[model samples]
Structure formats: C-alpha cells, structure tokens
Target: MSAEVDRGNLRSRIGMGDVLVVMVGRVGEAALVTGECEGWNIARTVGRVSLAEAAPVNPEWLATWLNSSYARQWCLSRAKATTLQVTLNLAALRELPVPVPPLPQAREFLRLMAVMEEKAQVDADIVRTVPAVADAWFRAETAGGWLPTSRFGELVRIGGGSRMRPHPEGAQPGPAGYAGPSVPVVAPADILQSELAHLARTGTEQEAAADVPLCPPGSLLVAVREDGVRVVVNDVAVALGRGVLVLEPESEDDRYWLLHAIRCHAADLASTAQGAGGREISHRAFAAAAVPWPPVDVRARFAEVAGRLHRRARTAAEEVGTLAALREVLLDEFLAGGSRTSRGSSPAHGPSVRGEGVQESLFGMR
Candidate 1:
C-alpha cells in the first residue's frame, strides 16, 4: 500500500478486518488486516485483491479457510497463465466454492484462532523485549567507561564458509578413506538470535576440516543479508555453511559481549549492506565495522548478565514454536471435522479423521 497516491478517485478502500488475497505470483497467499488501511492506495500490479465478508460468514474464518488445502487446490485449478506467473482474477476467485458452516461452528473456530493469536502476540513480545533490554544495559554499562571503539577486524578474524555439494549416496564413512566423528554443519538459518547450536546437516570430520573451516565454541556467526543482521554465539564446534560469516574473537571470553555489540549495531550493518539481488554486508565491510570495546572486567560482567537474559528469550521462542505447531494441528482437525456438519449434528467420521481423539488428548477432555 502506498500513501503517496491520491485516494479521492479510488473506490475500493481496504479497512480493518479486510482479508487480502495475493492473486498473482505466489498465487494462493492470503492475509487478514488487523488494522486500518483506509487511506493507502493498493496496486493491482502486485496482484492483491481485498475481500469483504457478508452476513453469516466471519472474515477471520474466511481467511483461514482460504489458506487451507481445499482453497489452494481450487485456486490452482482456476488460475490463468500470465507472461511469467500464474494469476487468478476476482471473477475466478468468486466462482470458488466456500463451505458455509453453521454460525455457531464458525464462531467456535474464530474463538480458537483468537486464543492462538493472543499466544503468538505474547511470544513475539518476549522475543522483542529481551534484545531491547540487553541493548539498554549495554549502553548504560559503556556510558561511564573509557571504552575504546575498535573495528571488528582488530578484535576478531572474519571468514566465509564453503559451499559443500550434497552427496547422492546414502550415509557412508568419512570422505573416501578418512574416518572420524561426524561434524555437524551450521547454516545461516540455524543461527538464531543470541543462540547458535542448530545443526541441519552433517558431514565427515575430514570433509569439514579439509573443505570448510570449523567454527569453534564461542565464535560469533552472522548472516549478511538485507532481511536483517542475525548474530549468534556458537555453543559448540561445527562446520559453517556458505551464507554465514564466522567471527573468531581474539579473547574467547569476549564472545557474548561481541555478540551483543553487533546486535546493537544491527540496523547500521543492514543500512551499510550493498548488493543488487539482496543487500549483503561483505566480509571486508563487516570486519571493518566499528564496535565498542569495553574493559575486560566490564565485558565479563555484562556477558554473565546477557547470557541469563538470552537463555530466557530462547526458552520463550521454543514455547512459541510449540504453540504454533499445536495451533496448526488444531486448525487441521477443526476444519476437517467441524466443517462437514451444521451446529448441533455430529461431524461425519472418516478413516483419516480423528478430530475428537486429538482434541481430547490436547485438552484432556473427551
């Protein structure tokens, strides 16, 4: 949505509770607007179309239904080919059949969705608050000290990792003749904020040592993309993937402090990123970025405090993931069984559907 365009002649205005369908490119994507977007101008070139709910159909319920497999299949069947992408016009979308369950059943589904949404907001709040608190603490701790500001290159060695080709064959021994323990590989996606130990792939120790450098514990891993600069402290030794840069601090104990410092300057790093396809901070540029270098005692004390806060944030994030998974399962079950019948009647049972049992297990009720 653009605010620069004149809104006087625009007939269709999106408002709070409106559902938007991405009709082109990533064809079936849908979203519900939780806030007002009345004055902004929407471009049809982006392939977005707004939906307003009529009586007996809740906007939230309709948005959820549009995201389900049934709606996706329907949209795919009706899509027309464009020069470079598939698209569905508003007329075609109108022809897609929607299940109209009883009003009471629709209300129940909305109620459940509200609960999940509330929990998601709480999780987001926790994830967002910890970093802000840490940033503030860092500023306060560095305010009084005669802390020298040093380029990251002066305090750490920065290096990019290798792109290892995937092997076609199943699990075997080391790279050809070498034999040693399997080395876990860490990619940019595996590097979470303030915590890094996620291993998505594994390779032979020989391959890791020979082809790609292994980042040791206390190394800072950074993702150099425009999405945002993500920084994490590695808790264990692992082989690095191509998308991440490993920052090895001269003083191993300075790892946590360095991670927090980089995080504080994340916005600055992102602004300095340069590239055509995606904004990226080059290895040399990232290494030359300035950071606050406080006294050893101050760093150690801050590290201890920051570590505790980061641990709590990690736990909260994990809980959010679990809750999100539970919400997905509930949505699947609710849509499958609850949509088949009216309010009072029992939903038709099928071999693949175990809605009642799953709900009972989840809520401890039959």
Candidate 2:
C-alpha cells in the first residue's frame, strides 16, 4: 500500500515498481514488475505491493531482499501451514521490515545484480533454443523416410545396471576384493535436472573397479521419467547408477546424431515405459525402436552443425551455474549489514553499503 493508491481503483492490473509476492504455495517468491509486465493481470493468490512515486527505496532492491533466504524464513514462519500447502496473509507481508539504503547506492547495488541476471537470461535462452534447432535439422534430414533405418540396439552399445550400495556413505561398490579410482556417478535425477542436451558434472562420485558399468566421455545418458525420455551427452567420464542407461556411440560422428535422434523420438521411447510407476523404460521396447540411419557423410554434416550448437549450449549452461552462485553470494553480502554473512565473512564494522571501502571491491564499483 502507498499514499498514491486510490482505494477504489486498486485493481489487479500491475504497475511499474510493484512487487509481486506469492501468497500461497511457495509463499515468499517475489519479483519486481518491469515495464514489459507493467499492465499484466495478477492472479487471486498473488499480492501486489505498490510504492509511492517519491519513495526512496528501489523496487528491484526490495524485490531482491524479499527473495533472499532470510525473508523466505520470515514469511514461512508466519504463514499458516497444512499438510498440503502454506499460505501467507496480507498482514504478515505488510509487517516485513525492509532495509533501505540511499537511492543512488541502492541503484548501484542493483546494477551489478542486473548484469549477472542478463547474462544468465542469455544462457537460459540458448539452452532452450538449441534443442529446437537441432530437432528441426533432424526432421529435415530424415524426412519422407528416404534414409535407411536401423534398430537402435544395432547402432550403439547400451550400458547400465550398477546398483547403489546400501552403505551409509551412499557409495557404489565394485566387484569383491577390488579397489580403484573414482569417477562421478550419473543418476536419473542428474539427467532430469540437466536443462540442455549436455551434462557437465554430477553431484556425487564413487570408486569404480573394472567390473562397474563405466561410461566414457561423449556417451549419451538417458533417464526415462513419467513426462518423457530425458537425455544428455556427458562431457566427462562417469559411472552409471541404477535407472541410468548409457548409449555409447562408436565414433564422434554418431554422437550428435544419436543424441538428437533420441530427443526427436523421446515420446515414442517414453511410451515403452510401463509399470506401476510408469516411469521405467522397457529395454525390449527401446531395443526395437526404429531410427533413421542416414549415410555417414550426411550424418557428419548434421553433426557439424548440431555439435557446434550443443557445445555452445553446454558452455552457456556452465556459465549459468557460475553466475547464479556469484549472484547468491552478492545477495547475502548486500543483505547482511554488520552481522555475519552467509559466506561466514563480515564487512568492516560499519554500515554495509555506505562509506565502506569493502563495498566498492565487492560490487566492482569505482
């Protein structure tokens, strides 16, 4: 609520400088209203906070603070929770204390955040655009059923079936009486979480022996979920865990071709997944699926283009991760004034944003 808001005219139409807060489910998720979305209508479960035109606080800065971990806990603490959902009322949101710096300092803080946010948006766009482009190329080359087809099993070797050990450490054991080097373990969750057509790393690694199912770099990892068949080209050597299948291509040319081929037929392959869970892919059904096998030279041509697009996608995904981490770090630093910060470091004992030399170094401000 602001002094300028008319009581009768406060409709759902959003305005610039309005902060949209989720009132249900995710409770505290908030975003700043920009010019692009200024006139959009908000749902009933959303609460809009409008600021007077002469308000000293920046809307983006307020929105950023609302989305921080501290504010999340604050909102959740006051929200009414049931087994199914959590709901925050307007009164709780109105009581949230916001720390405001001078307009120029707040704007400077936001400028750095905006730079990282824009870079991340660009990378996210690449991750989404690459798959469509690659899929189009696949359809164009394989159109009209002109290329001779082959069973999927014949084109590549399928590998999987290493189970996770029941040990407390969650490590995967090898054949008895064997000890060897460790490699990152790819699981169903890893494949499902990957946004692009490539996977750069996994969260956990296990000691692998000679008998463990090992997928070398450049192999396609597939995870059949309830939604569809998820796939990614692993850029590093990784050991496979249960529910993760590896498709090993014989050459570099076959790599991208098989990658896109599996993506284009994701729905058909997912149809084979049948069980009580309906999330597991039947090996027999997958082995018999028809795949378009074009000439090696034609595949090489598609590979040359698709491969470049996927590689760029992977690079962009990596940058997205880096930018996200840095943004979180900056948010924690900015929001925590003289108290200990999330990274376990504190600014020189004074105001967090003003007149502190450390602020200049942290935000890259001159």
Candidate 3:
C-alpha cells in the first residue's frame, strides 16, 4: 500500500490511461476487456482484489491464473454484487490470491501467454479484414463509391422479428414443435453475447410456427429490443447498441454489401440515434436512409469480389478456431507439466489433435 491517495490529485486518479475495465457482471456475456486509448490499457475488474497485486507475483502469472477455468469457477461462486446484481467491488477485488513462482519462471509464463495473445490477435486481424475486403468488392467495385456518405436505410433493408406472447417460464427448454423452413429461434442474449456472427439455421416445424421468426436464409436478423442505454443491431456476434440497424439485403448480391456497410457505420448510428429508455429507430428511419450505390454493373462487380473475400475470410476463421483450441491445449500442457517434456521436446510444441468432430465456432451468434 502506498501513502494516502489524494482525492483531488490528478495523477493519482485513473481515467484516460488506466485500463478500460470490464466489471465482473459484464465480462462473460459482454465483451472481454476492451482497451483504452492506444490499446495498452485493457484490464478486468475482479472481486476482492486487484488480481495484479494479490499474488505478490508476476502480473503474467496472475494473468494465467485469472484466465484459468478453475479461477472462473471460484469467481462465479463469490462474484461481488449488490441488491441489483453481483459485481466486483474494488475493495473486494484486492482479496483474491495467486501462485507466486520464481521471477524467472514468471518471465517464462508471460512469454507463453504473450504467444497465446499473439495468436488471438492474429485471428482477430483476419476477421477485421473481412469487412474491408467485402467493402471493396461490394461498395467500391460494384457501387463505385465506398464512402460513409450513404446512410444504411437508403442502402439496405431492415426488418423486425416476430413478437410472441411474453414467453412463459418452463414452457419448454428450446425450439419446441415443428419449426418449418425458418431457422431456430435464437435469443437476444445469445446473439448479443456471442463472439461469432454467423448462425446456422435450425429448429422444428412447431417451433417455426410458434416463436421463431422465419428470416429468409439470406436476410440478416435485427433485434428491436432495448438493453440499458442502447438498441442493439447484432451481427458477427457483436451487438450494435440501440438504434443500431440490421440490414437484410434485398438480394443475394447485396447481402455482404449491407453487412459491410452496417459494420462500418455502427458507431455512428449509435451516436446519432436518440431515445429516452433506449435509442430508437423507426421503420421510417430505415426506409429513408440513403446509400452510395453506383451503377448496376458496378454492383455486379462488387458481388463477385466480395464473394471471394468472404470465402477466404470464412476459411481463415476456420483455421483460427483450430488455433484457439491448440492454444488452450498448450496452456494445459504447461500447467500440468506435460509428460512430453522429458522426451527432449519443448512444452510449447505440444502434440496437436486433428479436429475430427463438427463443432460450433466460438465467434458467432448462437
């Protein structure tokens, strides 16, 4: 502990450069810590203590400890909260503990986590490129103008989902009954919280008739619901906060184009929209929005280019999922002191398992 922190002291206070924090309640379903300016300040708020301090240990060691599944379980059991909900209070945050390794070992630990972080970064970099590529193909090549000057409603079509009676508790577990041609009924929570944006269509005939909205295969789904200060338009597993629009392209040729535009303008939409409880955008708002559509020939050119880029993005994403699993395996091998270490092999070069089963990508809407 240092000397008394002066309330009026600017240096002692954290705002600009301190980590952009993820409170305990918001971490899992919300996002992982989003970094503050220039990206050096990403951090999480844990209950009972600053995880960086409690172990009297290397911050890297602390990072690995906090990231472990076991630690998540422990945090779940005693997550800090008030009457409204559980939250990590700063005073409580200081109480957590970590395993202190020798300084040298701690250095190694940081090195390994850094590698994992880098792989994760690489995966993200690939995903970020998808939009730019899509834009070049759809907007610039096809429409001839790839500028933000066009509003989404003018460029794409947005639609509402079906409204069912306020769903009753324990009526059933999931998509019940025959869900015909439509995809399964996915919850707002699932879409808003997921890291992946693409969702496989699934459900029974009855479910289709009852709750699930029958969004055509090519149409992107939008949530009209409100959460906190914003409305959410969700795609690619990220929620466009309230008043954010979801575009379902008018034709197959236009789908990726709309997704690209919506992604490009998400923040701007959120900022410009206004409402009391949640930011509001009416159907009129969408119908009246304008876009920079060039000529029909250009639109056709963009479609071909974007389709190729999208396919590449999809393939890269598939590989990234495999890498994420590999990273996890490496984490386990190091933590358990794997048997292969005695065979003259590095622990970092853990054996890889070929992905055999059909598995869900962790990056999308549920």
Candidate 4:
C-alpha cells in the first residue's frame, strides 16, 4: 500500500453512482451483485462502491486478484492477529495493494477458470443423486426388505441447547490456564464435517471460569439456522456453537446412519427456519422434521452402504485437508517464484487458476 493511491477527502467528495462497489473473495467468503451502491461510506468500507470514473484503469483484475491465492492470503494475513477467528479490517483493506497482471494474463486466467468450471460441473452432478439413493434404500427396506418403521421423534431426542454468545474478542487466547473442561467449544461450522468430532478443548477450569455448554457424546451436531440450506463446518476441533441442534439417536444404526439422513433432508431443515431477521431455528422445528424411517433390517441394509459412503467421505475429506495443507505449502513456494511444487507437480493447485473455490464435499459426520 502506498500514499499516492490515498485519497484523503476522496470519500466525502464522491457522488452517488460515481463508483462501483467491488467485492472480492472466493465464492465461499463473499456475496456480490445484490445491488449497486455509491457514497462516502461506500468508499470507506470493504463492501461499498463508487463510479467507474473514480479509477478504472487497474480495476479489471480486481476480482481475479481477490480470487488469487496470493491476494487471498494477503487479505487473510491482514484480517486479524489470531488464526482461529476471522476479522477483516475496513481501513487497512481499502489501502491494500494488488498486482495488476496484463490483460492477456488476466484472460488466460479466465480461460483456465472456464475449463475447471466445466470439469467441476461434472463433479457436481453426483451431488444431486446421492440423496435419492439413500432415500430409496430406506423406502425399499421399510416396505418389505429388512428394516422397520418408526416416527423420527420416536428414535431420537432432538433438542436445541444452551444459547451461545459470539466469541467475545476472537479466538480464545492460548491455554485456558488449567485443564478441567478442556473439551472444545464448537459451532455448526465445526460439525459440518465427516469423521471424528473435534472441538477446541476448554479447560474445566475455563468452563468454571466462563460457564460453557457441554457437547453431547452421542449427539449428531447439526446446523439448523439458515434460510433454505446450510453447510457443515470445514474444520475439526471446534464445538457445536450457537445456531446448531444436537440429535441423540436411540440406536447404533441411527448413529451410523442419521448423519446421512439429515443431510438428505438438509433443505427441509433450512426451509423450516423462522428466518424473520437473523436466522432462527427451534428444537421443535427440527424434532418435528420428518425422515423416511425404515425397519431395523432396512436400516442395517442402508447402513451397510452408507457406512461405506461415510468411510469414503471421510477419506475424501482427509485427502482434501491434506491437499489444502499442500496448497498452502506450494503457494508459498510458487509465489516466491520457486521452480517446482514440493509435491513434484509442475504448477501447484493454488497459484495457478485451479480450484473453483467450493470446498470439495464429504458426507458429514454424526
């Protein structure tokens, strides 16, 4: 960031529609084009906009730059002092710098993105049919094959638990001094995952220090407060935070199978929300939410397959996590103009125009 790019009275002097508010991020972290905005406030904030006349020459690459690993890392580095919580700065953000690649290079990036886009559309096709496979297995088994039927509420107790306070200042700093309730505090984002549940362990001393909620042992932690759909958290070692529901299913089969079932019905969960303003999800809404309950034998049968899906899903997630770690490693190398990837690939995943920014999906865990 430099002083010449600084416009001291620039914000207050701008007129309405004098600029376009440009938002930048991978599709996951940002929303754009909700509408146009322009003003002094717009110029001062990350989400605000102004006219094309304001400064258009070096702007064409803004979105791509934001999408770039170098740029994304820069934004993230500037976000906060801590690693766990995200905190973006407004003033520092507007002062940030970007490398303006020539138009030809920018077009090459776009062309590469288009190719990755088509391949990804194929990957997305599997996303649509997996649920039906589980649903049909349930139906066929409950109707005649192996499993029996019961009301969903009969098999599990679904309850929304203690309300959560947003992390007071960001990620809790360091060790909580002692180790009594070291089980991690969690959130919906934490459990939107596959494999073992992870929460940052709060010291029992910390719980005594700060009065935290207990995570249920057999509960399937679910994110219940979104408009029509929600995503599971991508990280482990986090707890079921606010805006989540915990399901304590009766049977071992339920433990093994309920996660898939809920994901199948994820849309319904979102639909039932009383989203008048901020997201509002109730225990009653989730408990009353139904699923196709098949007999025990049918559940056993479904579990046989779902167990495999769950295992494969877990492995896939682990692999992606490994790739993400690798992406970070290679990003550091390539961005420094290193000759090759640590993994031996010619060009690594992040720096080049690869990855559509959607996290690769894995069947979430219970």
Candidate 5:
C-alpha cells in the first residue's frame, strides 16, 4: 500500500523489501531492494513476485532461493526470445518451480548467504572509498601550490589499436611468424572501475599474434563511448579492441597520477565525445584536453599515495570474487541436497533442522 498519490492515480509502489523480477529487457533478472522507493511506478515489464507464508517460512529465505542458480536456470529455460529481446511473461514465470526444503534447512541457507553478502558489502565499501580517498589526497596536496596546466597530448602518447582481421585458421602465429606466448585481447568490458585484470581473447597464440597490436604493461586503457569513463592500468601486455584507447605516459612515474587525474575528470572527458552511430572521444580530442601539470616532485608524492590505494582496491576486488565463487559452490551443494549443514558438514557445527512439516509455496504476482 502506498501513502502518496499523484493526480488521483494509484502508483505501483515498491518499498525497501520488495523483490522484483525483470520480465522484458533483461529477462529473469531479480533484484532485492535494500532502500525504500515508495510511490514509484513499476513498468509493466517488471513483475513483483513473492512467496506465500506458512509457519517458520521466512520471506528473505524464499527470495534468496529464488535468486539462486537453480531458479535462474529454470527461468532461463522457460524464457522466449524474439528479434529484439527475450521475455518471460507472468504466466510462464509463475509456472517455474522451486524445491520446498524444510524450514530449518532454508534458514540455514539464508545464514550462509548472509555471511557472504556481509563480506561482499565490506569489500564493496573498500572499493568505493579508495578512489574518493585518492581524489581527496590529490585535491589537498595540490591546493598549496599553483600548478601549471598543459594539454594532455604534451604529456602522453595516445593511440588506438589496429582493426583486427580474423584468420581462417584459428590461433595461428603472427604475420612475423613469431610463435610466442598467447596474449590476452582487451575489449571495453575488460576495463573495470579501477582495474583492467580480465580480458576476452582467442586461445591460440597464432590468432592473438595475427592482428592485435600489443600495448605494454602500465599503459592506461580508457573506454571512450561508455557512460562512465572507465580507466585502468594494464598490468600485462594486451591487444586492444576498437572501443578502447591506450594512453602511455611520457614518464612511467606519472602513470599513477595520470590515472587518478583522468578518473577525477572522467565526466568532462566523456562530455567531449563526438561521433554518429555512437559517441566517442577521438585520439585528437582526448590528447588536446587540458590537464593540471604539477611539478615532478608533487606528482611523485601523489603517485606514491595513489599506488597504495590502488593496491588495496585490487585486493578487495579479488576477495569479493573469491567470496562470490564460494557462495556459488555452497548454493550448488545445498540445492543438490549434498549438504546437511551450512558449513558443508553434518550436525557438528551446523544449525539443527526443525519443523519438517512446514508448507512452502512460491507465488509470482504483479
């Protein structure tokens, strides 16, 4: 029930605890709202789904179960694809079934999931705070001295990768016939908020060598047309796809400062983008953008601080990835009836099961 009304229209409202299933654009996507969003109109494409309650049956437990791999697979299997997008209608979604585990078992699963979620949130907080700390450090240290400004082109070499041509024989040696180690090819997706550690690539060394030009480690990679200006340090040699731009600093010591500067001014850089099909910042425009050019000593100091923050952020991201993998494994084991305890053991350290006769029902309604 919503307290607020607009022009006598009863808005489709969802509150802090509502769980919504995306029915159209991103079919089968489920999100649990942790914040309140009252009097908000939900589009027809999204369905508000809930489970019916019986004694000792927790809603949070049911919602978590619905978002697990078991439910995701069921939803994916039933979704219908059209030319534009895939969709799962309300009727079809309602028919998807979930296992009715005993109440104690469901609660135990929720407890394990809660532990993972808590750790994820802590890691996420670290990832979010590190950049802001870097930004603040830059602002504070540069406030005393009036630094001279210079065009980005004067300080760095900016270039795009050559367009790749796929070969008939997959993963063969390069044009030079050099059969070295296979290099990871980077697309826009490889550039995360603060790092570029993942890449999409052909498995064969030959395929990687043929067309992709390698950008050396420490080069700053930027995604031009994306909504958020994503920039990251390339830790390894990588070939860039079309959507990416590589910025190589004249002095390697300036790399950390340059990365932080670009991140701080990402919105401004994104605004200068221009193109027809999709907006993109050209090499020329990107190079010509003005940047604060502080003294070498000041930049070095900032770089030292920024490097520490970057390392911490990287560690947090790795921890989050590890926890997510563990959570997935736990969910798989629980759903498969292979685990009687939350920690994957028998009655030793796990929660004791009770209320075996509890009734369970999964309800899908708008």
Candidate 6:
C-alpha cells in the first residue's frame, strides 16, 4: 500500500479540502484533508467527499458535524455488524445529515473549535513525549548496569484484584447497599488502550469501589496482551479488575523508579505470559525476572528529577477530560442553533511546557 505505483492511478486519491469519513471499522470518524495528505488515497473502507463548487458548507464545519455524537449514533445504528468489524454502506453514508449554519456563524464556531483542538493536541503530545524522556533517562543512568540487581518481586509488593460479588448476566453489580461516588474500574482493555503514562479515566465506573480496596494513585497497573506487556501509573483511585496486576511501591521514593524499572523489563515480563491465546502474564514468571536494583540514594535522586515531569503529564491528562466535556457542550449548542448570537472566544490557557526545552532539561546529562 505504501508503493508509489498506485499514487497517480487511484481514483480514491484525496486532495486538500476533501472531507474524509471512516465507512467501516471505527465508523463515523471524520476529518478535513489538508496539504499534509495532498496526494494520499484512502482505502475501500474510507469514504471521501469532494463538495461541489457552489456548496454553502465549509469542509471543517461538515467534518465537525460528522464527528459529533448525533452523527456517530446515527451511523452506528445503520452500520452493519460483521464478525470482524462493523461496515457502513455507501448509501447510509450518503444519507448522513449535516447541519449548515450561515458562513459567519460557521466561521465563528470553527474559530472556537480550532482553539480547543490545538490545546487538546498539545496536551496529547505531552502525554506521549514525557514518558519517552523519562525512559531515556532511565536507560542513560543505568546504561552500563552499574547498580546491583535483584528479582523484581523482591523490590515491590505484587498483587491482583479481589473477587467481587456475583452479578446477573448483562448487569453490573456493586457491593450490596453501597450507593456512593463511583471510581473507575481498571480493566485489561483500559490498560491496553491508555496512551498516557498515567490513567485518569476508563470506560467503566462502579459504586462498589467504596467497598473494594481502591488502589491508591501512583500504584502501577499492568496487563499482558498478545503483543506484549502494558503498564501505567494510575492518577486516580481505581478498583482493579480480575485481569490486571498491581505493583505497589514500598515508599514514595520508589514510586517513579519502580515505574520506569518495570517498563524497562516489559519484554522480559512479556516472555512469561501464558494462556489459551498466549496472552496472560504468568505471575510466577514475572516475579522471578531479574531487574537492576539501584541504591536508595540513586532512586531518590531519579524520583526527584522525574517526578516533576510525571506530575505535569498527569495535570495535562486531567485537563483533557475537562476540555472534552466543554467541547461537547459547545458542539451541542451549535447543533441546536442555541449559539447563533455567540461570538467565538480565544482558547483558554493550558499547562505550560517549552516543548523541546522540557526534553533537554530532563535528558541533560547529570
């Protein structure tokens, strides 16, 4: 598919200003084509729309409406469920409704949207970049294997989730008589999908967390997938599911150190996995794997240095949720014609980061 032979021959090729919609798999995902993808072509599963010369809609506005909850629900309802994935037929896609406001109103809405999207993208980049910096530091400081090493189990407490009360099929059951605030239920799927080093949210929440022993923030959550091991430092209190393993540090000083240490040993831990599909992490094998055990002073120093970066990452991660909720509210108002008189506002300030400067500060040799 990456071959150049298909470049000029394909009719599916998209140019700037074309709107794209995912017609299959993750149905309803939409985007406006920019110069970055000038000559690129979409697969059979993707639908491209080239507007007529006199059409009254802007590509960005149309793309935004297609990505909204209203449009997503509409597409999902009509998409055909297949064994491997859902498929959206061309007829259904053609029937998708788009709301068009006057050019002035559309431009104002786009102005506000661009601001929020820019802020969210910066935070997303931070979530991905900070961990790489920390991992680089971990590799550099322990490069020559100067520190003494020991079995991973000896360095931290290893445990799994407790058994929950049985519930009827298709229903979620909480601890009896416990009706209170909800906490995220940390599942293997959540661990697999987490892009940030720290998890601030999950798909499922339960009031039963009040009765379950919540894993405090800062504990490491680990899961094994067919590809390899996945790990993240949880930011909020979360109740563990049956498939995840928790690595609780013995002291605050060891928290970040243990995090990077386990990450470094991901491949080694992954080799221990065994299951029907070779996807389960073997607890016995993982505990027995060897890892570098640095001295107390070394760990404390690394923790002190890396802790700041991790905290910033966590802050940005939390802000993403708030921004997302606000975006949805504004999107709904625009859809309902409730924001006709509203003028677009500038983006709110987000957590400050000096992009490459932060990396240099973290990776600068000691």
What order do you get sorting by TM-score, best first? 6, 5, 2, 1, 3, 4
Which of the two candidates, 4 or 5, achieves a greater lDDT against the reference? 5
Model 4 lDDT per residue over 148-210, tens place:
334457678765545453463344433357434334565554444322322223221113234
Please provide, for model 3 over 176-292, each residue's C-alpha lDDT reduced to its tens digit, 9 standing for 90 to 100. Answer: 455344224444443444333454421111223444434445555543334321122222222122233445667756665555554454554343334574435555655565655
Deviating ranges (above 4 Å) for candidate 5: 1-11, 15-17, 23-27, 43-45, 54-58, 73-92, 161-209, 224-228, 250-252, 339-366
Worst lDDT 10-window in candidate 5: 344-353
Mark the 10 consecutive residues where model 3 has the least summed lDDT: 357-366
Best prediction by TM-score: 6
Error of 2 at 328 (Å): 5.1
| 2 or 6, greater by lDDT | 2
Among all windows of ten consecutive residues in candidate 4, which has the lowest summed lDDT?
357-366
> In model 2, which regions exceed 4 Å deviation?
1-59, 65-100, 162-182, 205-212, 325-366
Ten-residue region with minimum lDDT total, candidate 1: 357-366
Cα lDDT tens digits for candidate 6, 1-366: 655645544667778888888877778888899999987767777877777655667678778877766678778889998865688876677766566567897899899999999999899889888888888888887998788988868878887775442221122556677667777788777788888878877766767535577898888889887667889988799888877888888887787887888777677678877877766667788788888878899888898878888888878877877887787678767655674223233212112221111110010010
RMSD after Cα superposition, model 3: 10.8
Displacement of the residue 115 alpha carbon in candidate 3, Å:
2.2
Model 6, CA-based lDDT: 0.74
Q: Give the Cα RMSD of candidate 1.
A: 9.8
Candidate 1 Cα errors over 4 Å, as ranges:
1-4, 8-12, 22-29, 43-56, 67-98, 149-151, 162-218, 223-230, 233-243, 249-253, 267-282, 288-290, 338-366
* RMSD after CA superposition, every candidate: 9.8, 9.0, 10.8, 11.4, 6.8, 10.4
TM-score of candidate 6 versus the correct structure, residues matched by position: 0.77
Listed in order, each prediction's TM-score against the native is 0.65, 0.68, 0.58, 0.53, 0.73, 0.77
Where model 4 places Cα greater than 4 Å from the true spot, the runs are: 1-70, 76-94, 99-136, 139-149, 163-169, 172-184, 188-213, 216-218, 225-238, 250-252, 260-292, 339-366
Q: What is the lDDT, from 0 to 100, of the residue 12 in candidate 4? A: 37
Better of 1 and 3 by TM-score: 1
